[model samples]
Target chain A: MIGDAFTLVLLDPMINFLVILNNIFFGSFGLALIAFTVIIRLITFPLTRRQLHQSRAMQTVQPRMAEINKKYSDPKRRQEEMMKLYREAGVNPLGCLGPMLLQFPILIALFYAIRQTLPESPEALEALSAHLYQWTYIQHAVPINEFFLGIDLKLAPNEASSYLSPAWLFVVLVGATTWLQTKTTVTTVTDERARAQQQMMAYMMPIMFAFFALSFPTGVSLYWTINSLIQIGFNIVTYGLPALKIEPLLKSPAPAMAPALAARSAQPQSVAQPAPEPRTPNGPGRSKRQNRRRRPE
Target chain B: MNNPRFFAVGLLLALFVVTSAACGKIRQPEGWASPAVSDSTAYFFADKDRFVAVDLDSAKAVADPKSTTGATLQPLLWQFPSNDQKDQDAYSFKAVYTQPVRDGDTFFMASYDGGLYRINAPDGRGERIATQADIKGKIVAGPAVAGEYLVFGTTEGHLYVVNKNNGQLPVGWGKTGKDLGKGIWAPPLVRNDTIIVATMAGEVRAFGLDGAEQWQKRFTASGAVADLALLGGDSIFVPTLDRKVYILDAATGAQKGKEFVAEDWVWSTPAFAGGVAYFGDFSGKVYALDITTMETKWKPYDAGHRVKATPVLIDGVLVLADRGPVVHFIDAANGTGLNAVPVVNAGTVRAGLTAAGGKAYIATTKGRLFVADPVKRSVVEVGVGGGK
Candidate 1:
């Protein structure tokens, strides 16, 4: 019963859409995957935007958050104050993860879709017949072309041809795009400890995804690369180019260490106010004149 | 952002990723069909592009020099595309999964490219009898050479009947003519002027030579029919993907008895002997059933791996090869192991065992052929030949 519902709700639609895309795009599965990623990202843009807004909101309230941490000597009161602060700012702490959580079902369905479209075994093909709808367009598209751009989409990027194959380019793209997406999505926290943890995740998640891309089928890696690129594009539109800049990452905790240096050189107030919401510069609080001055930085 | 709900969503995403990876299915690779042995030669798919003809006499002569190489002994014999042609990439050029069938002096086989070739058995000379343009889809099943015409089904759910001599389709024998409405993975069983073809949609249909439908049987709950075996001169034993064997009457397409349920799918062709049918399932258990009564003859034989190969009988011993690197020999009468321990050295025998001239030939996925004698309890490996 669960299988039937899953097929009806997610797998069937994904498979049909992919097949139709393949048919429209001259049977190039690679191109079809890119088109599908674009469609999925477009459909999920609102959810992703909500998550981005929450992350930017969290950044906007970081100063008040740090002030609460400093004022409340008691840990319990600090926690209560933080929740109250979030409520006043109209930010849901869980909103940043809601879009990611919703993406799981779609990701899994796409995995099954790629496997079903390019089944490697005779038994798999036979089993796939049942999942496919009774349509002539789909029936004629059986035994889909696994080759695109000289890579067997059914095999891993490394396994497709050999070393330095076209799949390698996909591996690199998946890594680069995933890194950029992660960079943009992560809120720049004012707390040094929390920022360190978020920065670690930003780098670690991309490397892990890239490793999987090197191991999974090229078709799957193509999906990841395209999906990541779409997310990165979405992030750039929402957060702008500075959030995507690798220079901040290369500075090695310079933003995190800035306040400490300022506390020693000047006042603690000057230290807390310098890095005010880098992710959302054009928002209501940060004036256009101030944004122009910060643009050169 | 770090809260119970945030961590809860992350946990769910991680759980889904692990679950998806764990539940990912691995299918049987294409082109693992067993070899067909004629009187003097053993024909098998060496790869997709090359269907090799191993001279049995030549192979035996090398093992025992006292044995003579007959007129058919041409060591490497003949392969498709000849020796000079650069073998096309298997991805671009469809590979041959169908076992080669010998009809008179010619060997007939179909490829993934939907081309049927009629090669002169003795020499390597052959011609492309049918192309994908003629059939309109890939040919997953081998050709069933019945009389002067050759019939085969395609992945496009269309059946094509063409002249074995010319490769041209007979008038009205394609998608426009008659189709099974689903892909046909197994070769059609031609008997009594009727072509019996099973579809991946869990359907069995028969068609006349004139491209007319005769009868159809549908198993709504059952999966695709993987293979068919004839029993009691009239009953058709169907091994299906739904893990059940359905016995149907050949003449009228009626159910003969209750389905024989298995632990998993019965994907391999079942072997019959002494009023009993022996087959294995994807779950690695072999079974013997009384064809007349639909009852188990003995306890299921366990091979501990997927048995996709059709079990063969040689000298009262049932040889069952598996998807792994082992082959088990059991006594056909009681389903007892004939040898103390099964031969665990054959190396991934996905193709079924071929028995001929008092010897059983087993082809491994590693491209090595092991010729075993059930009587002597000996197996000898043959050298690679035909194509590189």
Candidate 2:
């Protein structure tokens, strides 16, 4: 029953929309997939933006979280303090998961939609007719041209007969863009152990998705590559290009570190000391240090 | 894994695995090869990879083990590409779609993987005659045997004419095969010296056995033609995906009359007997049209589900199976339900129904076979190798 409802609610709509898009894109299923990715990304933009904002806020509170971890040895006390710190920073740890969760259904449905729209076999094509709406336009568009930019969209990279086939190019793009998307994402981990794990994930995720692209149809790989590219753009916009020393285009609404840094600086000290500034790894501060060293006396 | 970042990544990976599993095996072909019965043994695809020969007499005598009476089914007579041959790369057919075409003592079958084999009926011993390299694409259309030549079309739009004796291209035919430029999903109809080939692009062309074009102009339908039938000796019945069946001149690719519009897409080739053509549409409505006037013989019989299998006339009763997997028996003379309650199968029936010895044989997508007695209005699941 759940499967039927899923087909009726999500898969059917997605398949129909894809068929319509394929028609609009001049029967190029590849172009339709790219366009579908863009549209899905746009529809879920608000949730994605909120997730990015939460990630940014988490990054700003990392120092306080680290301090709390050090001061409170008891696990309970540390967890309590951590929750307090999160509340103060206006960060919801689970907020980052909202968009990810939303994407799962869409991804699954899109997989089925791609398979149905660009059927590889005659039986698959006949099976497709049952899902189609009675729309004459959609009906005529089918037995869809599976070729897109010289690649058979129904074929996976592993299914490619030769190493030189264009399908392998999608595999490469899926890996490269996934790595870039992960690398460009702002890190929120303060603990050394967690930070190491996060860093490892930044590498592992790309490899994992790249491996999956081998088994997935080239159309799906194309979607992943395009989605990852869009996400990289989103990451750049939200977290900025740290390597290029650019500030985030959209600043965090709360600026969670400012009050904490100011309060710490106001505390009286026996000896003169520099006020603690929130560490922005590979951010403007690192560029400032580099600029200072480059200056001539 | 203790870290929240790790947890998130782990969850994402878990979801990927679950979704992939839920989506089922990617590119797995579901074989719906119809049964080809010769004498007491029925030859059909038992699975995507297993082609078995079942004894019809044993199948009828075997009681349903699932029933309270407790009688087990018998083992199959034989199966092609035996356990030993399955491991050999050359013997793999992958997925058989074409019904095994019997020519005397040997049966010919083609697979979706583009391999063709000639299997002897007695022992089920088979040898690959054509490989994927020779066909260049998947074979969905069944091969038609014409004297010494066996003709079949591929999904890549190439029509192959190989010698039936050996899998070699005939000497007079094109070296690489004639490129139709569109995928052929329907089996080519062989009539006299000409071969009628219908493509997925909805174009119907006639060609001679020597690979020469026999038609001055090709008849093009609005939708893809899935199956074709010979109305008489001179006319062809073309069932198309556009919900219209057109009668074309068999000698020349010309329309004989206006197309008969159906309630839905017509995929099944019309079963002809007497002066009427019997068929069904995707909408579950069985149709009977007079070949002479191209008019309806009676009100369309409602089968209550999608009908993909071509109906077979058994003892003057029209036996049809629907996507419902429900077998309906209709009176051939006038379109009326012959069976009060239809016998439902365990899976969807896509293969064309086969009639022999006054009974109808059905092979479902789930690999289950059924033998229906038209006279008794009863259907029995034919278990194979002690299993249903």
Candidate 3:
């Protein structure tokens, strides 16, 4: 049932739209895929923008987060302080996830849609008729030209007749653009372990997707290459290229921190004096500390 | 470890892995080559790449091996590109779409990889007569055999006429092939010296044995013609994706009558018997049209699923299978349901039904062969050895 709903809602519409785009783009499926990627990016712009803003806000509160970690030795106390800090800064730590998770369905749907639109087999082509709408223009537009700039869009890089085919070029573009998109997006984390994980991901994701492109059709690779290129553009506009010292083209609202967070981080710590505690009623008292000391012995 | 960035990236990578695992396999063509029966044997693709010759007599016996009438089980006759020859690249045809056309003991078949083969049906030993380099396009439509000349069209829109004996292009047919400029998905209809070829671009043209245009007036449909049927010697039934089937005069390629409209795209080539045309549309409704009046013989029977396979007339009953894979039996005269409960639980039938020995032979995409008995209202899988 879920599969039926998915086809009804996403796959069918995408397949039809692709055929229409193929007609409008002079029967080139490659151009249609590129246009499709651009349209999908535009449709999801609001989610992407929100994710960028959340990342920026997370970056702005990094210093206060570090301070909280150092002051609270207890794990629970540190988590509480972190949550409080997050609330004060108006940042949802999980906000960046929503947009990324939402895009998975669209990406998978696009994969199936691309495969259906540019069928390589007779059976696949006949199957295409079922997914298509009843429009006369769309019906005539089929058996669309699978060749784009001398590369068969229906074949994968591994399936290419020669190693030097244009399919390999698409694979390279998918990897390169993905790496650039990842590198350009600035991610901030208070923990060293998290930063290390983030750095590893920046390299891993590109290599992984590039490997995937070897197994995927050239049309899908074209979609990915164009999608990553658009993402790189979005990154440059939203987060800027820090390594190249380029400021974001668009204004970000998160750089202006909340007053409560600013005041807490601005305080001076005395190395010679004992730290003050008992800020909240649930906070550990001296009796709890005594119990900890007695239990260890 | 608790950072949202790490969690998000990890989740995204995991989703990619799941998505890739879900749909990783490259879509390979599942051939729908229907069984081409000649005498006691049925020839078809037992699998996508393996073409086999099954002894119909043995298959029927095996289907009911314990019959009180002394039926005994037996193995298949032979399979082409045998297991021993699989390592040889020359034997690989990738996928076969065109049904094999029989000429005596030999059969001619075309593959999606553009290789044309002539196999001796008695032993299944095949020779690749033409390679992909020779054809230059995938063959979707089956070759039409007319005497010593064998003609076939490619998805590249070029039609080739070759000598059945030598596999070489016949004299005056050009060095390569005659380009029709549109992909030919429907098999060309050959009647004596004239070959009628319909294209995916909706052009219907008739050419002679020497590749000369035979029709003076060109006929074009609003949509791609999926299949063509010959109604007697004077008219041709062109079933198109435009949801209308046009009856054209065979000699001049002119409209002979009003086009028969259907609820959806008409892909099945209408089966004709006694001046009545029987066919189904993609919308699952099967209609019987009386060519004398160009009107419905009866109300269209709903099979409740898409129908792509051409219906066959067997013993006064029109037998056709829907994409639902459910077989339906309609009365050839009145279009009433013949079988109270239509034959169910069959494989998806995309190949056109072949009638032989008073039974309909069906070959599915998964390479399973079935024989349906109209008398018994039963569909039985013919278990060829090592099938699917």
Candidate 4:
């Protein structure tokens, strides 16, 4: 487990790089953090791509889902038929959340690692500063000069770094990058409601992350910002590559049964779906039970 | 696992190494060393690494004695914990061995690594008393307990008055936690209302009880002092690294008398007896100075090696253990060697005589606390001391 490809591909090399950067850059731990973000994004690229693919699949099946909802308008019937439709399409509704769950520990470990780059207490950090074996380009990384333009990367707000002396530049930069990343991911939308929801998240989540980043060390913010840019680049390459299959959005036809026709055309239609796996009515009431079974929602 | 634990362990370990090294030698590198006792426990440096206390009545730590101290002495009771934090990272700093001094129930001492500790007098149960005040210098002089205050000089030429009960501590500053001086290595002596302290810079200062300077004086041959003892009728007798002792008037800060011409430095605080003083030098020679004539007394020292322990004047008998096998007993009135008896084991002695009840309590570098009837030469209670 310790020497697996996932560990090597994800954690170890990055940690080594972080330690190296931390040593040479005595005056600042920010670079070490940025390096960590880049490493994490690189490692998680495949998963991010998979999630994006799943999202596109969900979008392609939307019309069929709408037809199923219309056929079983009753709540209980709709739920059942939805499950059947999902099974036929071979899509797990929550499969897209896998990447986020996998990245939790990485996020935590990175947070803790960079926090050590610049620590509080002049005494406690002395050893760590002296132990700087990487980042030799910087003259002195001990004080991690100006917190990359205002953040006192050593303090944790409750201690020394406070809102009074907030690192505004770093905070704003982090917020901007985060906003950009969120926008790129959730912008593949057709409906105004989904777009509005995406807009709210794009603004809210970035602001939240930025607020937390300001109170913490700049090393962490540096990680988040640089990581966001890397992810944004990756996302643009993956999602922005394909142009729109257009002419559909240009003419908004107000046909009353347009949704019905779209749904009818979207499905594999009649026989292609619903496999003929088995048909055995051997029990005394087997035929009656099969007939009474709830339809797929 | 957490920040504070790691920080504390680091601090404690530093204190330990310093206390062990300083306490190890049973004397400071530059001056004299002594240990003070209050409640059956003796507090002194095992070496520079840690401040240690052994139940003077116990024979436990003395068994299977080992000299792993990296210095001279190494035993658990003689073993020290570690040191705390420092300003400039002292990559090469080591604790200067120091003896402990007492005031009431508290024992005060400093680790060469930068920790002025106030441990319980009886059990050495790390009480939160303040003896440390953060000043950038080596503390070789043990702290002199004055009432509720402690007076000591640092490697830098500054004297400090620490709070009675850790009003400001850990960082080794005043109650408000501020740097006050160059820091002391020698413990201070309390006389009436004044505290007499000395530094390695050869500057001595008399500070009032309120931490204000009363007077400051400089000595020509400034180096390091081993011990400071107040002479009778208001005079301070100081032993120096320059192989001499200077007697100064307590009131006017005037040099009154000077005697003793040892080949090496005389650092231990000499024992005073019927108008005479008995001391030892680092080269292992004990000398006695006549208090009246300021001349050499009849016998310099009764032992064969250096006298590290400060002699205690008991019923005209100057009783002490030093660098040799036997505890020397001299006539305080005449400088005559009365008797020299063998102790528990062969380890060097770390502390002096603290006479309590009818027995003499002695702590050795072997970590054995002995409660012996000076006349019997037999062990009292084996493994019966405190400060675990």
Candidate 5:
């Protein structure tokens, strides 16, 4: 399906229009790609908006989930409690996941789309025929030249050709930005179990995105980097700023809610209750200081 | 944070990327070059310095200009620049040397290192007129002459038609300036007043003298056009690197039918003689194909790398030059090699062979120019057109 959309839509039209534009502009593939990318972005705007709302809703539910887990200590009952929690919050946990899941098909479509615009696929003509929109400009389209901003679209980074100069840069950008995007979303740690899961994801997600950025076309990396920056902007606007505002929001108009939080903290976490006092690397230094003061000063 | 207003931002980001890409304009083509034709006068880079002009009155096939065959023939007049050495260096950079447009007055030319040029008649007279385009790089093909214009394709994949009468300013064109998408190496065809050029990407487009494209045809199987032969009614037979010769309607750019010939490759320009198209291949076999049936009527082998030279048609007999030290005299009726004219030390014709003055002028890679008169069975070194 990815191959289908790419062939029919992305690579095919871009190749055709770029050639015509090259004919008109006299062979500038860079301008061609830039112009073509804009056309695609405009067409897919509605889907992108829907996806953003879903991500924001997903972020909102994480703390509520931690609340449900604490109230129902049994795993089976906790899952039921979490469902009840979701029902009360009027948000589908799946609603948060739904947009991400929806991206699978579009991602494949995008992957194929990028690959289609990319050269060296060996069976591109057949693929192009299947997926490319039959329109004008194809009458004179050829495989694009390799001089677009010094990146060879015809070459994939492998021992077959050689590593691209931009590959490392792209990998670094992907890893760094992915780390930032994930790091900025402050998942409230209501307990040890949730904190462990969050920490695992914090390290894992960036590494996964970094590996993906390495072998892709410089154009795709450009797109992803641009997309990531857009996501970052969205993160800042919605999740990023708001996540930081968590402390301030906690000082809500409702001090009544704060009494509940104080009551919850008052209850002992376990008989092994070494959990409170904000677990830290400083261990018992403060506790030892308190004991000294308790030594009848 | 719980307010869903955050999504308005992702939509905005998409809008930004799209808008920037959609709006930016493109830059212009780098440079342009015209083709050079080595004919009777060693004509090329017309306005520049030194060039060898052959004595056509001595090369008999062209001396008598009354014949239908000799109408296109003219003397190879050698021009020596006032500064011979520098002129020779300048001549080496020739970009275009078109066939003579008038009997003795004008022809088209350009230099790969220089620019476009339109020079005077024989006697090697006057300074060269230049074109606005800075001709650059390895100009492999073209400078095809049609009517009053010098038609040619560039390394930049553009086809240009410049005025031969006026200074070689680009008069009319099909492509805006470049990316006609594929470079054209084979010289374009001018038949019944229409100008035809083929692309490296198997596209055949025809245009009027003023640059209006008559039709455009893409050969699906002919990835690259190797040669084109005009067959009236806007139909042209094109031999392609794709191993097929496609017949296209020049007016509509529609494929009439494709004739599959060689199994490996066909590089030689197809010859139209006695209503048949003859071309040789990597296998060195010359196939005589019936244009109508798309079937091979005859096949003759030369056991060479390529039969790249166009077959010279004379009095219903077909003669072709090969990669050999030999010239082939093939029976037009059957694809049999009737005689072979050997070039004691041979190379792919270092330059195109011009048979005039009742002799075949052969230039080889070894830098030897031979004048062979078959009836006498003798070849003498008339001049060396190659560099020292």
Candidate 6:
């Protein structure tokens, strides 16, 4: 039942649309995929923009959040302050995740769609037929040309006939653009522990996609590569060059400390001494001690 | 607890794992076994495990469970042994390609597992008389039997001539044996005293009764050749992966007339009736060519899917099925669709259309059999499990 619904909702439409786009693109499967990716990116542009805006909002409020952590010793009080700060900034902590979550379904659907578009076997051909809608244009577009730029769109990128094949070019694009997109979009975390995790992901996500592109069809990798390039473009437009730039100074603990110190020094000298407690690894205060203890690990 | 980025990282890992594992193969749609309709019964390989026999008159399983007096009800006339492990890789390209060839009282079948079985026609009980496991090559095509000799080809690039009487391979076949150079992927066409064999190496050779090559001709690029059709016992109509059908003189293997160029590869064996040859290309275009003039008699009909199934001529109508569900009936003379909507909303048919006893039987990959009476303009879908 779930399979039928999934085909009906995503696979069927994607397969049909891909076939239609293949016709429009004059039977080039690769061009159709590139066009399809562009169209999908445009359709989800609003959500992506909102997600980027939410990430920027999160970054802008990070210093204030750290200050709240310094001010409140109680865990509940710290959470309340963080929630209040988020509300005042009109930022939902999970807002950036919504679009990413939505894009997952589309990505999965596209993967299957690419596989279905140029079916190698008769069984797959039958599936392609079933997924295709009854539009006259789409019906006539059966057996779309799978060859584009010397790559058999059905075979994996890494499964290229030789090292000199164009499939290797797709692999490079998938890897490079994925890395660029992740580098531009990943938030610069303030907390040491979270920053480490974020940095790991920034490296890992692209490498994972690149590794997957090796085995996935060149057409799908083409989609991912183009999608990544589009995302990099969106990122640069949204946040400027600074989004892509990873400064050594920004990597230091100095920027995080500066904001907390600046906020603390505004208070009286006696309260300022308490600010140092927030930095202590084994600080006696509950939230400060918990956070500091968690950071070193 | 407060690390959204860390949470996202974990989720990405999980997604990678899930998608990678799930990405291996989409659910194999279903098996496609074309119906072999005899006078009273339709024998079909429903799947790897089941070879079902259905009563044509009642359009149901021959074995009626409700009416049987025995304690245990045998559902059909017979089913092949249901061994999943033995037939694990049966759905691949090497799976059964030959339609059940009935010779005398026995039916010869070549399965995907590379087993050639001789089933008793009366009961369907079978034995694997030959196997690829023993031959060291999968039998991708054939069991086209004649008289006492059964001729077939294997993916191992050799043709085997097996004795139908005792199921023993003749000495002069295969690599450790004769070695036909490349694989024979299509069933050879046997005529008179000679058998015409098309090989994966793109060479068509006619072999004499004594297993000696009579005449050989290379027509296309080295790969598998589609089954060839004989035109008036003088010309050989062979489709090739080269996207053109070549008409070769049967006597000398010389080119005859112009090459029929198609938009895509011509894989279906051309069917000839009344001087016009009908066939479909991989691009879903069906053409009716006048062999004498080497020109298309009418505009090609687009069936809107890959037409792998050979077009059959029934009662002056050219019947063909595509990879899609719909079967099209084209007017033999004009190439126009016969029905109002051209038989809309039927089972997805990949198997060839079998016209027998004034009706056409279409077996889909999903195992739905559509019995269409073109005279009546009506179609009845037979159920997968039991016949309808």
Q: Is the docking of candidate 2 incorrect, acceptable, medium or high quality?
A: incorrect
Work out the TM-score per prediction: 0.62, 0.84, 0.86, 0.43, 0.47, 0.59
lDDT of 2 by residue, A1-297 (tens): 988998899989999998889879887788899899999899999988888877777777776677665445446756877786776566887777776677677767777777787787767777787788877777666577788989999888888999999999988898899789878887766676677877777777777777777877788888888888898898888889979998888765754544754465356542222333344453322345554666798
Q: How accurate is candidate 3 locally (lDDT)?
A: 0.78
Model 4 Cα lDDT, one tens digit per residue, A1-297: 733553346444444466556555553456556555665666877776666556555555666665554344345656876676555555555656656555455554454444444433212222232233333332122223335555555454434434565655667878899777765553334434445655666676667666665555555566666877876675565446234422222122222323434455566667333332243453321344344653464
Off by over 4 Å in 4: A1-297, B1-109, B120-133, B156-158, B169-183, B209-212, B216-223, B342-345, B371-373, B377-388
Give the higher-TM-score candidate: 2 or 4. Answer: 2
What does candidate 5's lDDT look like per residue over A69-169, in tens digits?
44443457567766654554444544433333433434333444445544332123223333333333442344344356666543334312355464456
Worst 10 residues of 5 chain A by lDDT: A248-257
DockQ score of the complex predicted as candidate 2 = 0.21
The residue-level lDDT of candidate 5 at A211 comes to: 62
Say which candidate scores most in DockQ. Answer: 3
RMSD of each: 12.1, 6.8, 5.4, 17.9, 15.3, 9.3
**DockQ ranking from best candidate downward:** 3, 2, 1, 6, 5, 4
Residues B1-388, model 5: lDDT tens digits? 1212223333333344334323422111111121123344443322323344554334343323444433323444555343443444433343232233332465445444334445555555445544554443334445656766666676447776666666455546433344466666556788766788887677777777866777655444335564566764456777765456777776677777556656534555665765577767644677777766778887555646455555555444466666665666666786666677777654444233455545556555443455555455455554322222
Query: Taking the tens digit of each residue's C-alpha lDDT, what string does model 1 give over B134-247?
Result: 575567766888777888887757777877886556655753335667777778888888888887777888888887777755443256675776676687888876677888
Candidate 2 wrongly placed segments (more than 4 Å): A59-82, A120-123, A160-165, A187-191, A245-297, B1-27, B38-41, B46-92, B121-125, B130-133, B171-175, B291-295, B340-346, B365-369, B381-388
Residue B201 alpha-carbon offset, candidate 4, angstroms: 3.3
Selected candidate, larger DockQ, 2 vs 5: 2
lDDT of 6 by residue, B54-118 (tens): 65555343443453432121134555543432354332223466677888778887764566677
Worst 10 residues of 4 chain A by lDDT: A246-255
Q: Ranking by lDDT, best first? A: 2, 3, 1, 6, 4, 5
* Model 2, global lDDT: 0.79
lDDT of all predictions, in order shown? 0.70, 0.79, 0.78, 0.53, 0.51, 0.67
Model 2: lDDT of residue A264: 57
Question: Highest TM-score: which candidate?
Answer: 3
Task: Please give, as one word, the docking class of candidate 1.
Answer: incorrect
TM-score, predicted candidate 4 vs. hidden true structure: 0.43
